[model samples]
Target: MTDLLARHRAVLPSWMPLYYAEPIEIVSGSGRRVTDAAGRIYLDFFGGVLTTMVGYDVPEVREAVERQLRSGVAHTSTLYLIRQQVELAEKIARVSGIPDARVFFTNSGTEANEAALLVATNYRRSNQVLAVRNSYHGRSYAAMGVTGNRGWSASTLNPLNVSYLHSGDRLRGLFRHLSDADHIEAAAEDLREVLATQTAGEVACLIAEPIQGVGGFVHAPDGLFAALHKVLDERGILFISDEVQTGWGRTGDHFWGYQAHGVTPDLLTFAKGIGNGFALAGVVGRAEVLDSVEAVSFSTFGGNPISTAAGNAVLDYVLEHDLQANARRVGAILRDGLRAAAGRYPIVAEVRGRGLMLAVEFVRPGTVEPDPAVTTRVFEECRARGLLVGKGGLYGNAVRMGPPLTLTEDEAREGLEILVASIATVSAGEAVACGVSA
Candidate 1:
């Protein structure tokens, strides 16, 4: 290990994982690529786990932060009214789509979800919460409790009485054999059962990721949440859309991933991709839900001037540049190329996701069992070819590709070629080891 890595291991929590076996120390980044400490450049497909929305070193965001630094204090502790924070809140409330939407800023996705849960449980007067299987909200005491991915069970800090609803993974769910409409119906019924038999009393809320992020970019049917929300609505159960990864047009079809489901959430939590690379995240909800917090509330580091300034610029850049439409166009190119490649390899069980958020799920050569070994090999091979992708899955066997929304057609093709070669190399080697063609 390098000195920096050795120091990192010595200081950082061991549970906090690194990507590669020999982790690259990223020293600089610009556009859609980053340069390692050794000065070798690599196309950054993961976008810092989907936090870098536009790209690294974008002038607009950098200048915005610079101006904020030159103008005033870095933080105001939310006790005093901060102009940038107010401006950002106004913008988010306007676009959040919730009726009479209100915004509360937090420092990260974990804090955002925690805030959302706090308001929800207080408003509903219940600690019982429901979530979907294979879902990942965030990492906090309450957020971790709602997470349903078997790989990440409720941690020791879990406090909420959370019950999972149903598996949302169409490829590996119990309803995998059903059609989309049928699967939606079955999942809705499962929620009804959870409410009837599982929950002790009035449930607080149901939190879900429209696209399961850390659970390997898994997706449910487009209208799945819409149906589930209908059931929750009847029971006075609030619905929280965990859009930390699927928000801001990353999913292509809609500005928010929940829109694809055709129902608006009562409360929505977001974090990643909002400030590009800055630490900005928040919860937007109905006036009543957010206003339910009667006590004094404010985050010390949440609405700092620097991060809010950067957040404003990011929203402007995404809208002015029409990056959402760009994500659609570019995402299609990447998905098509991957799908075509998957057709050639039985190890690739599915190519999933929308817009710039895409994933390739690997399995045993002739079966549906997850093959994390091959997935890790693909990750290493992609790095060798100057490409950086992310690894995730219920079983750690999915290669998630969430490049910057500004990814161009040529970049998509270029990255796709490298990924295909890496997958091909790994598949051929696996075949040789197994004494059969893959």
Candidate 2:
């Protein structure tokens, strides 16, 4: 079977990008480690793009899924009663501190965003949605329309209702379009002016990622959202927080990324770590906002018994173990280690992000030009040394590391050592094992 899978991949062109696949096939995973078909084990710092919050194949999650399977009820229509779904929704809402919120489940993050767009536009009868440039929402047509990454999505330039607000100044170029004190006032004023010029009651929502995930993990400018939120609130515009990537304790200090900014979104979306690997996504919003479209909104596999069971188990484990506290502890260690490594290496331009959701920017040794080639080399070297990471940022030169919240200090240090060595070797132009292209 392994040989057959290898042969199948061999027939495909090497240049064919399989959405970050790196010429390797995995056979199994357990507890932050994956075993490739060749029996090579690797530490998975990427956490399946920060979705595997509880680590790979956690026994608690497995046991919950198995228990649900034995009950002869897994997937079910939303038309019927599902106790687990309600319980899961309550748990998520309680943790999020948004009491007057309703939860709508979906199969993935993109689907969650799709439902949000529908709810925001249709319920309010508005035509415009303002998002951040370089923000990533999802890949479906409507969700893709809101996402601002040009390389990830094709720019059809159709008459979509969504418009984007660009960040004002670059924060040292490692990050972009950031705002300072004066810039924050200017950006807020600019947005207010734009809203005033638009047709009355036309803008439905102003969507944003509390911490821009695929947009290079850029946090919003200081006081940017607080100032902007005032304008949106005055205009009765809904604030939507896309927490698909930053929710469920990936930010360490806060359960939800928006908490770091001290804002409560009218509508919030979540996926990834909420299920800890099981397929699930959700949209939580104010009761009034949700009630506006309750009669019209629908999803088939939104909140299945099995998925909700898994979600319940994930939440139980998180709270029981205080995983959010763990995330805070381990994240500090990771940030310090990576930042120190960055300070030591000239090739590493910046190490930025809060908590475990961190990234190291690769640049020209003495300049700000993005060094994608060097990044590609470093990724390959890291893979050879039994560590797995991810890449993002506008230029694809940021090495993103979002390990499971369950990772211990020792494990975090081990992963950092592997990354440090990989960067050092790649900087010296040494050959990396199991070479793969970006």
Candidate 3:
């Protein structure tokens, strides 16, 4: 290990996951590419865990932050009026699809979800939360409590009573044999059963991601959440869509992932993209629901001028450039390419995800058993070929790719080629060793 790696191991928590056997320190980036400490350029398919939405060094975002820096004002507590914060909140509310929407900004997705949970439990006067199996929210106590993936959930102790429901993963669920429509009905029925038995029927909310991010881009069938929402509605339970990974039109089919199910959440939490790598996240909900938080609360640096300025620029760029449409178009190309690769590679058990947020699952040939060995091999191969991706799922046997929404068709094809080549190399059982290159 390098001296820096040794220092990282010494200081950082052991549970903090790193990508490679020998991790590369990314130094700088432009567009969809990053250069590591050793001056090796790699196509960044993961986009810093989907936070770098527009791309690295985007001119508009840079100029906006630079302008804010020139103003000689940066931090002002949320107690004071901030123009950029208000404007950004307005934009988010407008796009949030919640009627009479209100927004509360936070510094990260974990805080945003925590705020959402606070609003939800307070509004409904209950602490029981419904979550989906194989789902991931965030790492904080409340967030981790709702998270269903065992790998991400660090402990069994939880702040709230959380009941896990079928997440609609067709590939690996009790209803995997059923058709899409039947699967939705089954999952909805499962939700009803869970609610009836698990709680006292006074649940705070059902928190879900339209697409499970850290769980290997697992997607519930379309309209599944809507079906479950009908049950929650009768019980007067709120719906909180965790859009930390699915927002900002990253899914391509809709600006918000919940829209694909034709449902509007009572509350939504977002991060990882709006500020294009800046620490900005928030909860958008109905005015009444947000107002339910009676205590005076404030975020010290949540909506500070600099982060809000970056957010405004990112949103403007997303709208003006129509990156959502680009994500749809190029993402289709990448998805088709991956599916085709799956056909060719026996280890590629599945290819899934919507738009740019995609994943390829590695499994034993002709079986659904996860092949994490092959997954690790393919990951190292991609790294050796100057491509950066991500890994997740309960078994850690999937490769995830969520390039910037601004990824061009050519870049998509290039990254796809590298990915397929790496998979092929691993599938061939090459004896190549893993680790960072010198």
Clashes (N, CA, C under 3 Å) per candidate: 0, 1, 0
After superposition on all C-alphas, the RMSD of every candidate to the true structure, in Å, is 1.1, 4.0, 3.2
Deviation from native of the Cα of residue 136 in model 3, angstroms: 0.8
| Ten-residue stretch with the least lDDT total in model 3 | 429-438
Backbone clashes in model 2: 1
How do the residues 1-438 of candidate 3 rate in per-residue lDDT, one tens digit apiece? 399999999999998878898888988999999999999999999999999999999999999999999999988789899999999999999999999999999999999999999999999988999998999988899999999998888888888999999866656778889988998888888888897788885899999989999899998889988998999899899999999999989999889999999999999999999989999999999999999988888899998999999999999999999888998999999999999878877788889999889999998777898988889989899999989999988799999999999999999999989999998888766323423221
Clashing residue pairs in candidate 3 (N, C-alpha, C atoms within 3 angstroms): none
What is the C-alpha lDDT profile of model 2 across 207-247, one tens digit per residue? Answer: 88877788778776645777889988887888888999988
lDDT of each: 0.90, 0.81, 0.91
Stretches > 4 Å off in candidate 2: 1-16, 19-22, 155-159, 168-179, 196-201, 430-438
Models ranked on TM-score? 1, 3, 2
Using all chains and alpha carbons, the TM-scores for the candidates as numbered come to 0.98, 0.91, 0.97
Highest TM-score: which candidate?
1
Considering summed lDDT, which 10 consecutive residues are worst modelled in model 1? Answer: 149-158
